[model samples]
Target: MIILGVDPGLTRCGVGVIEAGAHRRLSFVHVDVVRSSPDMSQDLRLLAIYNGLAAKIDRFAPDTVSIERVFAQENRNTVLGTAQAAGMAMLAAAQRGIPVALHTPTESKLAITGNGHALKPQMERMVARILGLNEPPTPADAADALAIAICHALRPAGALQGGEREQHLTPAQRQWAQAAQRSSGRGRRNADRGM
Candidate 1:
């Protein structure tokens, strides 16, 4: 399976493509940082990101697109730009009917380095080791994209098929499922209390 992972940003969106083989093996196919000038108009910058991702989607014909889920931060502008780029990535995959999977940074880090709070250098090193590269992929964004893809690649087959077989889930999936359950449980509790 060919998977395209996107680390979205308006100024430097990182994209990584990998081919997943039998038995959880993964091979790197491509890595790039799509850049848009900060001086460019907002709409134009967005268009450039969209076009860049679309071209790659066309070139790779990825089976699935893995993208970093947008999270809130102190800088609202950064968050907005990131969310926009993420939307472009989703749009590019949607145009080709390719499924898109959103993975949180914590999830990716945990899957890649076995630590949800891993630092950037650690993630880069792990990603390099996993792909059998001589060195880590340059510019943190590129490595981050690859890590996201690896995280998705590591998921158990049953998880990919929409099965909730806890025993078949990887650590990342188990954590995500537990988090989801906790959030839903809170909602159920609130409903019970007539909130």
Candidate 2:
């Protein structure tokens, strides 16, 4: 299965493509950070990002697209831009009829480094080690994209299919799944309380 992972941003979007082979082996096919100038108009910037991601989807023909889920941030501008970029990624995948999955940064970090709070350098190192690269992918965004791809690639098939997947997950995956559940529960509780 070919998977395209996107780390979306208005200024710099990271794209990584990997192939999942038999026995869960992964081979990195491409990694790049697409850049847009801030000086450009917002609509133009978004267009640029969308075009860049769409081009990758067309070139790679991935069976699925994995993207970083945008989370709340203190900077509203940053959050808005990120959300917009993420929307572009979703649009590109949907236009091509490719399955799209969103993974949180914590989930990706835990899956890649066994720590939900892993630092940038740590994530870079683990991603490099997993891909058997001589060094980490550069500019943090590229590494993050690869990590997101790895997280989705390593996930059990049943997990995505809504069956008894827990029985097949590795120990680390179980932990990640449990944490995700707990996090979602908290969000629900907060929503119920009108927070």
Candidate 3:
């Protein structure tokens, strides 16, 4: 399966594409950070994020798009920007009819590094080793994007199956499923409104 992972941020959104095969094998396809200057207008920054993600989706044609779920922070401004960036990612995926998954930072860390609270350096190292890269993907955000993809790639097939099987999902996976449902619902509502 080909998965595109996004680590969304106002200033620097990390994007990574990976191909996963059976037996837990994973290979990197692409990784980069989409940057917007802090001095730019908020609308322009968001536009850049949206366009960058859209272009990547078109170019890579991922089977699914996985984004890091936004979490509340003490700094409300930072949280708001992250949320907006994440929304851009979801919008791009939705526009293309690609399935989307939202994974929490802790969930991705645990999946990649075997610890929910793994440090950034440790997480980077693990991502590098898992993808067999000589070095970790540059910038912390890029590594994070790759980690999100790896997390979804490692999930059991049944976890993604709907209905009773979904009940067995871990808390993080359940959150992802709920977010995906909400996204699809919003798309339907937008279509109803002729958006």
Candidate 4:
């Protein structure tokens, strides 16, 4: 399975694509950071994110998308942009009839590093080790994206057997599932329109 993972942010959204084999081993396909200038208007910035993610989706043709769930932060503005970028990711996946999974920060960290509170350096190290990269991916965000993908790829079977009926999902994950359903039709329509 090919999985695309996104660490969404208006200024520096991170994207990573990985392919998993029958033996559960993973290989890196691509890693990138999509940047939008702070000086750009909100709509323009969001457009950049949407277009960039859409292109990645088309290029990678991932089987599924794994995205980091947005959490409340002290900075409301930051949180809002992150949520918006995340929405763009979902839209890109849904447009292609791809399923989306949302993983919490702690969940991703634990999946990769065996520690919920692992630091950035530790997480990066594990990501490199798991992918057998000579060095960790740069800019932290990229590494985080890769980690999110690995988390979903390595998730226990019990969690994914029920489709969207999986239990213990966070509110953000449930919301993503619903949006993906709604967007599935929209995706076809958009494709018809050459969007």
Provide the TM-score for each candidate, comma-separated.
0.80, 0.80, 0.80, 0.81
Question: What's the lDDT for residue 11 in model 2?
Answer: 95
lDDT of 1 by residue, 134-175 (tens): 899877669888888898888645434222233246668867
Residue 53 in model 3: shift from native, Å? 0.7
**Residue-level lDDT tens digits of model 4 in 96-158:** 778888877888888888889999999999999888898998766698899999999888666
Best candidate according to lDDT: 4
The Cα error of candidate 1 at residue 2, in Å, is 0.7
Report lDDT per candidate: 0.81, 0.81, 0.82, 0.83
Task: Indicate which candidate wins on TM-score.
Answer: 4
What is the total number of backbone clashes in candidate 3?
0
Write out the backbone clash pairs for model 2.
none
Q: lDDT tens digits, residues 1-195, model 3? A: 899999989899999999998889999999999888899999999999999999999999998898887866526778888889889998998788777887778878878887899999999999999999999887766988999999888765654434223344666886887688677764233222210
TM-score result, candidate 1: 0.80
Model 2, span 1-195: residue lDDT tens: 998999889999999988989988888889999878999999999999999999999999998898887867536768889889999998998787677787778878878888889999888988888888888877666888998899898864544522123323666886776678677664223322210
Weakest lDDT window of 10 consecutive positions for candidate 2: 186-195
lDDT value, residue 40 of candidate 3: 93
RMSD of each: 7.2, 7.3, 7.5, 8.4
Q: TM-score of predicted model 3?
A: 0.80
Ten-residue segment with the worst summed lDDT in candidate 3?
186-195
